[model samples]
Every structure is written in C-alpha cells, then in structure tokens.
Target: MSMPQPERLHLDSDAATGYPNSPLPVLVYRQVLDISNAEERADAFESMFKRHGWPPAWRYHLYDFDHFHSTAHEALGIFRGQARARLGGPNGQELMLYPGDVLVLPAGVGHASLEADDDFCMVGAYPPDQKPEIERGDPAQLAAAKARVAAVALPEDSPAGGSLAELWREDS
Candidate 1:
C-alpha cells in the first residue's frame, strides 16, 4: 500500500503568541519536513497529506519560493543553503541546513526553524498522532537544527495565512 498522507488541521494566528495556533476543538501538534526542490517537494507534501487524509495544503505554499521553511507537523526541508531548528523547543532550537540536503521532521512534533542559510526551501508537517520522544541527535545534528531554526518570517514569512492556518489548526 502507498504511504498514508497526514491529517490536515485548521489553524489561526495566536496574535498572542506570534506562532500559528490550532483552532479550538483541535490539537496543536503540527509537523515540519523537507524533500529536495521546492515545487517538487511541495507536490509531494500535498500528495502526502491527501494520501493521509489532510486537506489540500499545497495551495497555501505557492508564495514562498525564497529562503523558505515552514513550521507545522512533520516538516520536509530541501536546503538550498544553511538552516537551523530546535529538536523541539520554544522557537524550536537553532540549527542549520546545507544545500542539497533533505530534512524530514515526520509526523507530530513540536518544532520550528530559523534560516541560517544563504538560501533554502522547506515544508512543515503535522501527523495526526503524537510523535515519539526521539533522543536528540549528536552535537553535529544539533548544530544543524539550530541553524535551520530562524525566526519564521525573516526567512520567507507565513506562506499560509489565516485560511491555511485555520485548516491546520483543526487538531492543534
């Protein structure tokens, strides 16, 4: 059988928190990820979500082609440059992603990224189930994730607005 797509949730901006938040009656664990190229991986992300029961999310990403990285459920990161992120922390951790690298934050995990790159591309993910508490990678990986964890907007801004956030917030 094909790999299942993730479930999509609705979202709203936590004007209070700056980070996007899930709507009431929804869960807050979104995912983040990356594959290779922007358009190609975006297509894959779309299909991946649909295959798993997520709403069509690709449309929310059309405007983010430069230094792009998303903060949501399991993420897909195809780095054109360096990037940073937390394994799971506030603002996530700080790390970096290198060119031609693909980072997959598969399924439900509290995560986010910072762009420490020359230029990069990535997509966020949100698996319906809670993620396993995997051990943090060694210093090398930690360093990388930190670089990938730049402030969400400085890199590419929120590609998905209220509507997309609303869709993502359903289970958050």
Candidate 2:
C-alpha cells in the first residue's frame, strides 16, 4: 500500500521559555503501518527506519515531561496502544497518536506525553550518525542548543520512505 502524505505542523520559537522549536514542520503520518499483527509492528518499524537511514534506538513510551533534542531529528513509530501527546512546548499543540501512526520531529521541537494507554509503546530512531541529547526548557541551555540545532545536518532520507530534503527543507 502507498503511504499517505504527511500532515505538517509548523511551530514557532518560544521567546519567554527559549524553546527553539524548529522551523521545519513536524510531519505526522497516520495509520501508515499495518498493525493487525501487533507483535511484529516493532520489527517492521525498525526495519523501515534502518533501511531509510534512521537507526532504531529505543522502544518505550514517550517521556511525560517536555523536552527536545538539540543534536538530532527523531522518528517515533507507534506500534502499540495510543497516546495523547503535546508537541512544540508548554504552549504547544495536543495531538492524539494511535497505533500505526508515525511522528517525525525535527531537532529542537519540544514534545512530551501527556497521557497514554497502559500498553502504549513506540520505537524511536535517529538519523544516521546523529545522537539525540535531551534538553529541557531551560533558558540557560537555549542558546547552545539553538546553535547545535542550526548546525545539525539534514538527513537525505526520511524513515517514511521519501526525500527528507523535499519534505523538510525550509524553502520547500
């Protein structure tokens, strides 16, 4: 089955708290995976992410506190259960994520899980050669994080099997 085009969400930088929310819009792909056999969904997501240059790094529920990664973009594939997450920061949008959904967050975009089902699980991945560093909404760390986020190289491929440049380029 062909994948659906992603829904993009553009967020602004939080001036007061210094959350350097990315200029690149967050991409959400709904029901992209076949979750009929829930047991194999993790493997499927892992394989897809690995094949597209985003190496699967972890399997767990999202953190309940707000945070962002300054050094790397991230891909989260929801393989089991469901969640209500806040994206962008304290003043960000609330989105409900279900199994088979994929969320692509650019570096510096804040995200946190507000609530989730008991069985909620997601597979997280990062771009090739990029390591994710957790950064809370600290004003002191904002400047350094912004610098690192700006210097992060864009990935050529997205975990969802398309040209990341085309989808993520600011000019796109």
Candidate 3:
C-alpha cells in the first residue's frame, strides 16, 4: 500500500547554538504502519526502507542530548511507544512521535529526545552508500559540519518508498 505525502517541517541554522540546520525540510509521515506488534512493525519499516534503497542501520530510542548527522540524512521509524522530541536545535520545535510515525531528517538538522515511555523504540536508517556521522552543536566544528552537510548528496529514494528527490529536490 502507498502512503500519503509527508508533512514538512523547516528549520533554520542557529548561529548561537552552532547548529547548521538544513535548507531541506524534515519529512514526517504519520501512522504509516498500524501493526500492533512492535517487532513486526519494525521489520515492515526495515523491509520497506531496504527495498527503497535506504538500509536499516540500527534500532534504538533517540539520544537525550541534541545532536545531528553531518554526512548523511536519517530516517527514524517509530515502532513502539511514544516520545516528544526537539527538532532543529535546543530552541527548536517539539514534536510528539507515535508508533508507525516515520521521521526523515536531512543532514545537519538537529534533533533530541525530550521524554519517552519505557518501551519507546525506533528503527534508524540511512540512504544507500551514505554513512552517518554524529555532531554535537560545537562552535569549533560548525564550519566543517556546514561544509559536509552541503556536500552530502541527496538520496535516490525515500525510506518510505518514493522518489526522495521529488520531495527533497524542490527546495534543494
């Protein structure tokens, strides 16, 4: 089954926080999978993403401290419980993510987990051939991170199973 287009959330770079937020908007697809079993839900997400050229990388909850990836974009498929997270940076927007919600974060956008239930979990993935590097909002690394973020190539497909360029290229 095909999913609907995602909701886009745009964020700006924060000079003070040294967060080199991306020009590309974060893509949020809500309730894409309604499977009641967490393991099955995660497997479904991984299979879909792998079929679309995004390889499943890990399974975990979001980090408590704000951080970003500079080398590759990220896809987080929530399979269990719920959490409220800060996106963009420390002073950025807060969003509640529930089971079956898929969050796509472009390179350089900051994100952090504010709070979550004990069972909260997600499947993290990256585009084919793109490796992720974690970046804390450090002043000394801002310039390098910005350069890396800009140089990172766009993915050929969305983890949710569509042409990522169609959604991500318009603004890029």
The global C-alpha lDDT for each of the candidates, from Candidate 1 onward, is 0.34, 0.91, 0.91
What are the per-residue Cα lDDT tens digits for candidate 2 across 34-144?
768766998999999999999999999999999999999999999999999999889999999998999999999999999999999999999888899888887777787
Candidates in order, TM-scores: namely 0.32, 0.96, 0.96
- Candidates sorted by lDDT, best first: 3, 2, 1
Distance (Å) between predicted and true CA of 7, model 1? 21
**For model 3, what is the C-alpha lDDT against the true structure?**
0.91
> Which digits, one per residue and each the tens of the lDDT, describe model 3 over residues 27-106?
99999998999999999999988888888999999999999999999999999999999998887999999999999999
lDDT (Cα) of model 1: 0.34
What tens-digit string does per-residue lDDT give for candidate 1 at 29-133? 222334556566556655555454333432321111112122233334242444565333243333444432323332222344443444445444433332223
Residue 60 shift from truth in candidate 3, angstroms: 0.7
Residue 49 CA displacement from its true place in model 2, Å = 0.5
